[model samples]
Target: MFIVFEGPDGSGTSTQAKILAKNLEKKGLKVFTTAEPSKNILGKVLREALQKKYELSPKAFQLLFFADREQHVQNEVLPALARGEIVICERYNWSSIAFGVSEKVERKFLENLSSSFVEPDHTFFMNISAEKSLERVVLRGEKLEHFETSEKLKIVQEVMLNLAEQSAFTKRSTILNATDSIETIAQNIEMILTPMLFLQNIK
Candidate 1:
């Protein structure tokens, strides 16, 4: 099964993804964890651009993201799933959609770009206020990315919520309150996946 976690920069999706993968591994489940923009060459370029090291128009950046995702799916995600492992990804298609729409890019174009990629069987949307998201990022003392500002985070969060509602038609999605304690949030995710894991084992 493919499981994805999505949210703003400081929404802790990365942390939760790691914790879930760790715990699932202790249970002896086969798990493969990854994130996007992936570790490939194009993903490296996108990461640099996010840090203001490169200037790209919104359309250009989204196109790079689309291209990176194609490589990611082919090179990493597919092989893990082929081995019957549970794939847990920190970010996926919705990240592109939310950030792209927030930057005023056309939604249909973004959707069409990702239409061929694999969709997650379950998506967890970590919902939090823009102020809270920015605060968390600042507390980490890391250099802020281009989209890490409070105003941009506000727009991105709203866009993600709207996307989450629309996503129900495609797959299972759960909205999580990211302000909760880390352990608590992980527990919530474990509860959701435990049953699914059981069903998979039986099948």
Candidate 2:
């Protein structure tokens, strides 16, 4: 099964992703974890651009993300899924839509473009307020990117919530509260997965 953990920065999706993968592995199942804007060539460029806060046209950055996703799907995601391994991805196709729309790109265009990519069977939208998210991000001590500001992230967070309501992911679309203790959040995710356990077609 393709499971995704998606949310605005500092929502702890990354941490939850690893926790889930680790716990799943402990169950003796095959598991693979990866994130978008991967560490590949195209991903590297995108990462550096964001980290450096380089001025970039939204279209150009979106194009780079597309390249990274295309190659990532072909080179990594598909092959793993073909093996019947559980794949835990740290972002979703909707992430691009959220980020792009927040950056002034037309939502329809971004949505249609992302629709061509594979979607996750289950997505956990890490729920948190913009102020809380920003506080967490600052606590992490990482250099802030241009869009890391509370104002922009608020827009991004709203877009995620809107998409979730539209069934952009899981019909029951779980919203994991990110402000809780790490273990508590992980437990919530585990509860969400318990019902779907038998449905997992993992090898």
lDDT of each: 0.91, 0.85
lDDT tens digits, residues 179-202, model 2?
889999999988888668776543
* TM-scores for every predicted model: 0.96, 0.94
What is the TM-score of candidate 2? 0.94
Candidate 1, residues 1-203: lDDT per residue as tens digits?
Answer: 99999999999999999999999888888899999999999999999999999999999989999999999999999999999999999889989988998789998998888788988889999999999999999999999998898887998999899888888666588888999999999999999888877887723
Name the best candidate (by lDDT): 1
Instruction: List residue ranges in candidate 2 displaced over 4 A.
Output: 168-172, 201-203
**Quick one: best TM-score, which candidate?**
1
Candidate 1 ranges beyond 4 A from true positions? 169-171
**What C-alpha lDDT, on a 0 to 100 scale, does residue 111 get in candidate 2?**
82
